[model samples]
Target: MDISIHRPESLSGSLREAWHRAADESPGYANPFLSPEFAAGIGGFRGGARVAVLSEGTEAVGFFPYERTSLGVGRAVGLGLSDCQALVHRPGVTWDAQELLRACGLSVFEFDHLVEEQKPFDRYVTGTFASPVVDLKTGEGGYAQWLRGAYPGLARTTLKKERRLGRDLGEVRFVFDERDPAMLRTLMQWKSAQYRRTSRMDRFARPWIVNVVEHLFRVREEHFTGVLSVVYAGDRPVAAHFGPRSRTVFAAWFTAYDPELSYYSPGLIMHLRMAEAAGREGVRVMDLGRGEKEYKDWLKTRELRVGEGFVSRSHPVATAHRLWRRPVRGLRNTVLAHPRLREPADRLLKTVGALRTSGGTGSGRERSGRADPARTGSDRAGPHAR
Candidate 1:
């Protein structure tokens, strides 16, 4: 096996074609996050982004995308934002972790959402967590019928809310793949407000992140496409979602709604609508990503295991990086794994959020998006912890 590193944009068209072929042939590598388009999207914004190609004779058989920092530290591309990460490769293709690291000029490679099937890096894994997903099936029925059949317990209540929402506001309508750019901006604003109100890091506050999302919104490809789904009440937008999808998989990414209309459960409505529409569009699965939440439990048909850890090559930089990051991840996992610890942590964060928002200059709804009394536990998006 021979390894060579190149900037994502520098990859030849034929090399990219081979990468897509590998993804199509491997069931485990089909997530949109693993697509070449996504890697290039990140590379366009992040200067450190690079793709390591593994070739056998004249044919490229594998691709590993990552971001490299000074002192030989490396991480999965778009680590905090990407829900899935892997060295996408064809079946029967394998490489030594140490050799790969040497070839890429890395002392350590860190990843949180590493796919379980990545056997070459299996020994580097420290912990594994569940990533919930919906197995979608479409036929004669539409969203309403599909919802009823898939989640009998949730269907009645959710459908009832949709009806009330329509009657009170206006005729509630859903667009599975909304092409409007304005709605995309609205989603970012709402997500920013949600983050601030939850006392979490506002991803949209970063210019690069905003640029990347905007760039991806324009990307339309068979292997990866940015989908923006929205729910409207008459002429008013009630909720919206923006996520990436491969040919067969849709990854649930950023989702937000009008805080004033939280009582109507717009967030839940948006997800159900997205799922049904996606299934109709030939999507076989909707990945909710690696996080635990009440909504995920209600919607997921199964869970995929993702590992987190560091792959290193006996260097001081590798050892130091592990020592610094491992404890932080460990502390966070402990809090999330147990309700006793998680509940207090949540309350503390909310208190801080309330204080922070109250002092800021914004509309009450925008300032307190996550603090709305009408928004129950079920309405919250899973925390995208860094």
Candidate 2:
């Protein structure tokens, strides 16, 4: 096989065609982040991105999209703090990993949430982390079965509440692709409000993030694109979700619901609908991102470990940085890993976040009002979501 590289001007026509073809030919198929449009939308800030094509004679066999960075480093295009797959290419195609690295002029490549099935670089990876997932292929029925078997009491109670919600409201209706821009705007508003109220970083405040999400919404491909779904009661939008969808995976990204409708568990209902829609669309997995959540555990059939760490080539500075960074990170992780210290640490963080949120200088009332009194756990929403 011969390998060639191209720097495409735009993700239109032939480039898109090549991307889609390679995506379809991939073993696990295309990841949204691997799509040229996604890369182009977000990669503008990282200098010009390039496409690496591996071909045999006249046929293209593999495609790798990447952004070259200074100091001899490269990252998957559109990876800027996002959690998903990287280095998408044909499954069985074999190339010298080191050669590719050299060709890309990268001394070290860093990734936070690399996909689990990427085998060529397995030896270069240092560690792995678990990302929980929900299998929605069974649809709502399958989810109910899993929940009943895993947490019988919680499942029963939630079901009873669901029934009560139906009784209180006229009828609970779930809609996938409600196609309301107003609904998406509302969801972003609520999500931003939740962030401020909880002393978390506001994602919608970022221009790049807003642009990327809006761009993804308009992008439609067979396996890789953004999907926005909303659930409603009567004419009022109760809950909504925004995420990237592939043929076999619906990566659960951002979600928010009406606080007034909290009693109805709108968020959970939205999840159920998302799963059902995914199954109907022939999707098999609903990647709930990372961290441990009761809902994820309830709906998930299995988990995959993935995380961001660094891999250094022969660069001494990069090697030293990796060595120093890991031990310090390990020590910090050790402290945070303790179950007992978690609560107090979380409370302290909440307090700090509350302070930051309330003008960065506030009296008790300002802080108290912004702080969620019922908040039980740390918001594990990672940097990728932003």
Tens digit per residue, CA lDDT, model 1, 42-119: 999999999999999999999999999978999999988898999999899988999999999999999989999899
User: What tens-digit string does per-residue lDDT give for candidate 2 at 203-266?
Assistant: 7888777767776777676757778888766677777888887777777777876655665566
Error of 2 at 107 (Å): 2.3
Model 1 TM-score on a 0 to 1 scale: 0.94
Score every model by TM-score: 0.94, 0.80
Give the 10-residue window scoring lowest on summed lDDT in candidate 1: 370-379
lDDT of 1 at 344: 88
Sequence-dependent TM-score of model 2: 0.80
Q: List runs of model 1 lying over 4 Å from the truth.
A: 359-383
Residue 125, model 2: lDDT of: 66
The global C-alpha lDDT for each of the candidates, from Candidate 1 onward, is 0.85, 0.63
